[model samples]
Target: MPSTPGAGQSVPGTAVPGPGPAWFGAVMGTGGLSTLLQLHADAVPGFATGAVVMLVLGWVMLIGLGSGFARSVARDPQEWSRSVRDATMVPLWGMVSMGLLAVGSATFVVTEARAPSLASVAFGVDAALWGAGTVLGLATALGFAVWLISRRPAHPLPTWALPMVPPMVSATAGGVIARQVKSEAIRSILVGACVVCFVVALVLGVAVIVLAYHHAWFRTPVPVALSTTTWIPLGIIGQSAAAAQVLSGPSLAGLARVYSAVVLVAGAGLGAYAVFVTVRGFVARMPFNTGWWAMAYPLSTCGLGSYFLGWQWASLLTVAVLIAIWLLCAVASVRAIAAPRHA
Candidate 1:
């Protein structure tokens, strides 16, 4: 068998180079954007208009950019089996993501631009669609986790990371109930679900990034591989947005905002780190690879970070940042497609 990255010297019968963690990470990473977008619209009244526009723009950036690299990486004949699975599922999630963008954007649009009744209908539909998408997304995450743990030979990573499924599912359920059921009696129930899912997701995302960082920084002898660290900003940005929504409670909200401040500040620090990494990459003249997509992910996180900060100027700035990323992704997609394959 060909040697795989992180291949098991861990156990017999265990498969090496399982796609589970990577796949799960991708799905959850996508949701980080989805939920954060919604949270932005929800928290900032009247800002929904801008939120919808930016959300669509961000979606375009992610899909167009992600598809490009996914295609490049999938082209390797050695990657055939994994590529097949990823290709099929990616499109499925893409459709779902697009549907989500559409519904979510429309929710904000109709709510703001149209009649209250119209907005209500849109919200109802949005709830259903968001709930279903959330559930499916969570399932995908769980599936990835399962795939990770199934390595007949054990990998050192914990199987619980795979359990990101439950939080996603719970969150979706909360969204659904919050939308569909009008009863105040159920409001508390739904709220609990939403909070649980969101909280669990936040913690898990942070955990993954931290673990990846530890592995890359401390465990590995080599300079921490940049690819593994790219997604850290996503969690940092996401946690900030989640923190903003928690502000409804005196104790919780106060604490949440404080926590969010820490994340925002950390996000700034990481943003600097990313720039340093990029400049270093340029100076070192690292070999070109699809891995450059890592740069864009952090940029997107920066956009999300700005969105979470909720300042009028900050949100607008983030939209501008998102637009820039969107443009970069478009260019990258074209290059990735036109360039000849080399591994």
Candidate 2:
């Protein structure tokens, strides 16, 4: 029930309280890193150990979210809704969905038991969580979109891409789950659902990114605290590409290849820009806060995208990009963990 400083309040050298959604970045970061490591488990030694660490980190963030929400509600019942309406904070809902997806993915990757019952149980649990998270994520995205359209807030930030990104997370997670299903009919249905989710996220995320760009160009530089959010659009691209790769069917195979190729280039470009902006902000002594977690999921997804493309095209450059992204995510996650905590 402890409260933290809101975003936009932190100054260099000052200890700042964290925001409710701050832990969300940890969820995204750990979850995304876990997924990336899971994908490259063959090449990477100790993949299980790395996944376990991320799973534990994800659980901690989940607990933090529960506690943070409880505290926020206790302080003001209306605060959560108000935050959802806030352009910068609305993306926390996507964190909730992505966090569930991350943990579920880690479970599938690390649980090595071959017994039918155990595998069934694990898949069942993962599927249930994915269903719930997807529902919540979609609802949050839709509700926020309606509110945004009606309210038409000025100076929108790239953080607006947050709510839209969750369904894509669900799509990626669902695609993973779909691969395990025995029924072709069921698998096809699941794959189709993932495709729909991908489209929704892509369309909405791009719109938000465009608005954020206009705001930044015409209005002002984005607040330093939110510099990390510029990477979110890359997350959308990366995650969608990952989902398409997983859900590639006879119908989607060609589209998936094209999607992966395009996103690889786009992700690399956006990632470079994000890195430059983030480094500049850090050099300017941007205060450490939960917002730094924003770097986690995006970088992780870009890595995922690169890995997918590498496999599809047998491209060494994409493989190298994946490695570099993994390292960068690791560094960012460690720094986020070591950041000053709110009392």
Candidate 3:
């Protein structure tokens, strides 16, 4: 029997006070959309305006939600640790990092035409933020990995892939910066670092994906709130492909091309599977939650990867894939923003 609300008790539809780290998902989703718009600004009319709006919104959410999250964690240390250990929440660190990267990408696009110096400053700031985020992200990923090994939680969800995805975010952002920066030495360092970051994230992420798939296959179904996480592996593959292409210098160009092709094909296959899974889950009336924001960044990154490969190969298919990705991302963003009142 369902329990009824008692006197003075919070009812099902009541607004809850305080904020959670999941709020960072807004920053991640909006920022990612902003970056995608910036990337395609030349092709899409009014993309600049859209990117700026989304970028500003992302920053607002970051500042507001970040402040609330910090306060909540400060007030409840044990709860903070528990969240850190949670497979779903652990990815908030990556979302924060990706938000910084998205802001940087938008800054670059918006300012490069009128204020080159400001764009450079923004790039520097982005690099600094990426550095800090990468360190924190890696530490958190390691901690979660250790906990998983020791605690051996049952029926781990695909969201476990969350903790391992951040370094790839670093790789993508760093690779972009490296390609644009003036100094050759700095470019080489950035490229090398991004390559290493990509490798680390790919290896670890693959392990997590395998485990999550095993659990989903043999154990229990994924919780509705986390259905969107099925796309995370696509994000990992897509980011890796993009980063590899950017970091592909003359010496490694051949290798990079091969790797990019492999990952692109892999990502496309997985994206198809994710689309089916997501549709079925949504049809089942998956309740709105912060996890819905999971739909944005992964799809954006996958689109980027498709663009990279298609451009390199001079294929018309890239245009079609990118258009589909853009539409999906738009839908996902709208859904995330209009999510239910319940946390």
Query: Which tens-of-lDDT digit does each residue in 167-234 have in candidate 1?
Result: 43345334434645678777667676567666655665556545544554466422333332343344
* Candidate 1, lDDT over the whole model: 0.44
Model with the higher TM-score, candidate 1 or 3 = 3
CA lDDT scores, all candidates in order: 0.44, 0.68, 0.65
What lDDT tens digits, residue by residue, belong to model 3 across residues 32-99?
Answer: 67766666677768766777787777678767877887887888887677556554355556666666
Q: Weakest 10 consecutive residues, lDDT, candidate 3?
A: 1-10
lDDT-superior candidate, 2 or 3:
2
Q: Sort every candidate by lDDT, greatest first.
A: 2, 3, 1
Q: Candidate 2, overall lDDT?
A: 0.68
Task: Name the candidate that leads on TM-score.
Answer: 2
**Per-model TM-score on C-alpha atoms:** 0.58, 0.82, 0.81
Clashes of each: 3, 1, 0
Best by lDDT: 2
Model 1 Cα shift for residue 57 (angstroms): 6.7
Q: Quick one: how many clashes does candidate 1 have?
A: 3
Task: List residue ranges in candidate 1 displaced over 4 A.
Answer: 1-118, 146-182, 219-229, 243-247, 282-310, 338-343
Task: Superpose all Cα atoms of candidate 3 onto the true structure and report the RMSD in Å to 1 decimal.
Answer: 5.8
Q: Quote model 2's TM-score.
A: 0.82
